[model samples]
Target: MDGDVENAPLTDEQVSDQWKRLADLINKLQARTDTKDEFNARPGSSLTGDDAWSPPFHVSHAVNACIVAGADHLHACKTLVVDAHSLHVAAPASLIRGSLENMAAAFWMLHPTSRAERVTRCLRWQMVNAKNARRALAPLDLKDPASYDERIATILEVAQRHPEIDIAAVKRGFTSTAAVTYADEHSGAALGVLLPWQLCSGFAHGFTWANLAFSERVEIPTADPDVFSVRFSTDLTRALYLVWAATNLTESVLKLHAQRSTPQY
Candidate 1:
């Protein structure tokens, strides 16, 4: 079926159930190593291969962000939580590329003032709304599959604009290198700088691994519990998730209907 019919309209209650189901699927995917390998195989490219598919990790991340921010902004709404460790999320290249570029642009625009912070905040806001927009998705009546072709074309346009984001420069400033690293536990690699000791003192001390193979490990520097010699932080992960989710949600929505409708928030 086409994307829209496949994603039939869910009443508010059904939407909640579907959202929960998606989250559970993500959690199960995370915990299954065999599933990850199966997903990574180019099944369609190989005639003998089983055509198994996995939800893109970025999409799951985006789902989580919508749940998180929506819970926060919608006020008194129930929160969604998933076991990240067990979720087999393979990071989508599209989200990684788009987020890196956005970050890079913001990094270049950074200044030691509230003005820069405001811009950063706005970018983050755009990302969150775009990602969790399902509750706000407008009505669409697809006459036929081709009716949504224009939306597909727009997706191509937006994607083509993303590679222009310069993640390399942002990494150089943070990690002092253009080379990004993949944590063994990550479905995809992360590119960012290590936090300086002076700046790391104020953060939380515990973290859990996702995507890659690693024991459930938590490292707190004896002197600076909040800082790490090597690792991704929950804060960073959450922010990245927000950006990824927004991007994918936006992309997915564009492909599902005849026209793009911004939420009325």
Candidate 2:
């Protein structure tokens, strides 16, 4: 599945078809709605009582939030390409990476049929969110130091109440590095989610190895023998296909979110 978009070259017709599909998917994603975008009073998101259940937290807020972000990333990608008039070497893949990660998070939360696991994924994502915020604020002098801790405690408290969720599993929270692969399995995309994500990740980080793997390099003749100058150029077809993978995964998220969302009253 991941091999659907590989280092191997595609024919002209294949390129044209995939590129058109990419555009169509992006257009569809932009047009999609985020209905029932509401949330409960937090510390917990629940059905009836003071108990902060995980299910409502995801269905009501987190999934919508994630899909919205994925849409924004694709919007940004379009803006960048239009503004620059070309893929601009690395930026498209970087933007696509972010979109895929956002979609992957949403998919991971919503793909599960069991409500307990679904909510658990959302809880872990939020737990990580709080932890990150706390770490970012650690160097600064904050008025309330325990705010993030309270958030973490809140997630754990909810997890504790759900007997099906293993307490230890939610400790570290969610990270796309491991979960992206799992989410990709359900994406229903020809070009699977994980490889494109990985390729885009390398571009996002500006890794030399990623460039070496994906780009065409030609040695430049330099007067100074000591300076081994080289020119690197990106393959537009390859870049587009990677981004297409992101759109496919994101489109899946949008549809899944609609199914999971409460109907608008």
Question: Lowest-lDDT window of 10 residues in candidate 1?
Answer: 47-56
Report how far residue 188 has shifted in candidate 1, in Å: 20
Measured against the true structure, the TM-scores of the candidates, in listed sequence, are 0.19, 0.80
lDDT of 2 by residue, 5-45 (tens): 54767787787776666666666566654433232323322
Cα RMSD for candidates in order:
20.6, 4.9
Q: What's model 1's lDDT at 81?
A: 28
Q: Where does model 2 exceed 4 Å of error?
A: 1-21, 33-52, 82-84, 223-227, 262-265
Worst 10 residues of 2 by lDDT: 42-51
The digit string of per-residue lDDT tens for model 1 on 88-158 reads: 12222222333333322222222112322222222333333443342234334324444344443433343
